[model samples]
Target: MIGGFGMWELLIVLLIVLVIFGANKLPEIGSGMGRAIRNFKKATGEPEEIDVTPENEKKKEEGEKKE
Candidate 1:
């Protein structure tokens, strides 16, 4: 086993992710992961949620339009 994962097992998983998302998109995936965890914590009543709301959704749409 390598790093507690069987040799080549992690490589296989990473290859699958690369095939699915491509290398150029990995940073976008990581940022999305951060956003998902932040939202989950806020839903569970964490001290901060970064303001998730329908209003935020509307604002997002508006922001996209402005771009």
Candidate 2:
């Protein structure tokens, strides 16, 4: 068993996914998940640099109107 999943079990799960999403879309799904994981890891290592809120947006709009 690999990671508590037998080969047959893994194959069956893959077949079900293939039936649901079809063979055509698997690469797209895989790449999107890969990107999401990469971005999540990158975000974890960085400090948040800005906050944008409704109040801040309104103030900026007002300032722009005055200018």
Candidate 3:
């Protein structure tokens, strides 16, 4: 009774998916789905924090001086 879907219902859905996609394509499909979910999370997630310590600033300044 997961999310209102019984075990049999879930098994039927999985069977249908397997039949449609074929066994050979299942791994590729799974990896593509994983990548899609990962990208979706990254797109909606917050911006990364910047580190602005004095050491980092000094390195930047040294690089600029070299240029």
Candidate 4:
């Protein structure tokens, strides 16, 4: 059971979603949901797990080290 709801209940909800949105829209929907969650976390002041520095910044740092 997931959060007290059984697997079948989850499946039913998924089916309803599929019927409402169709197959093609699912990926876009999922990505939008992910962005929403990420934004919400940021708004709540949660620290990100991974800090991504841009490639140009990394190259500059390496060049400075070499000089």
Index of the highest-TM-score prediction = 4
lDDT of 4 by residue, 1-67 (tens): 9899999999999999999999999999999999999999887896656559999999999999999
lDDT of each: 0.88, 0.94, 0.93, 0.92
Evaluated at residue 67, the lDDT of candidate 2 is: 100
Candidate 2 off by > 4 Å: 1-3, 48-67
lDDT ranking of the models: 2, 3, 4, 1
Candidate 4 RMSD to the real structure: 8.2
Q: Give the TM-scores of the predictions, in the order they appear.
A: 0.50, 0.57, 0.61, 0.62
What are the candidates' C-alpha RMSDs? Answer: 14.2, 8.2, 7.1, 8.2
User: With candidate 3 superimposed using the best TM-score fit, by how many Å does residue 64's alpha carbon deviate from the native?
Assistant: 23
User: Mind giving the per-residue lDDT tens digits that candidate 2 earns over 24-63?
Assistant: 9999989999999999999998987865568988899899
- Candidate 1 C-alpha lDDT tens digits along 27-62: 999999999999998788855546566887988999
* Candidate 3: tens digits of C-alpha lDDT, residues 8-37: 999999899999999999999999999999
lDDT of 3 at 28: 96
For model 4, the stretches where C-alpha displacement exceeds 4 angstroms are: 46-67
2 against 4, candidate with superior lDDT: 2
Clashing pairs in 2: none
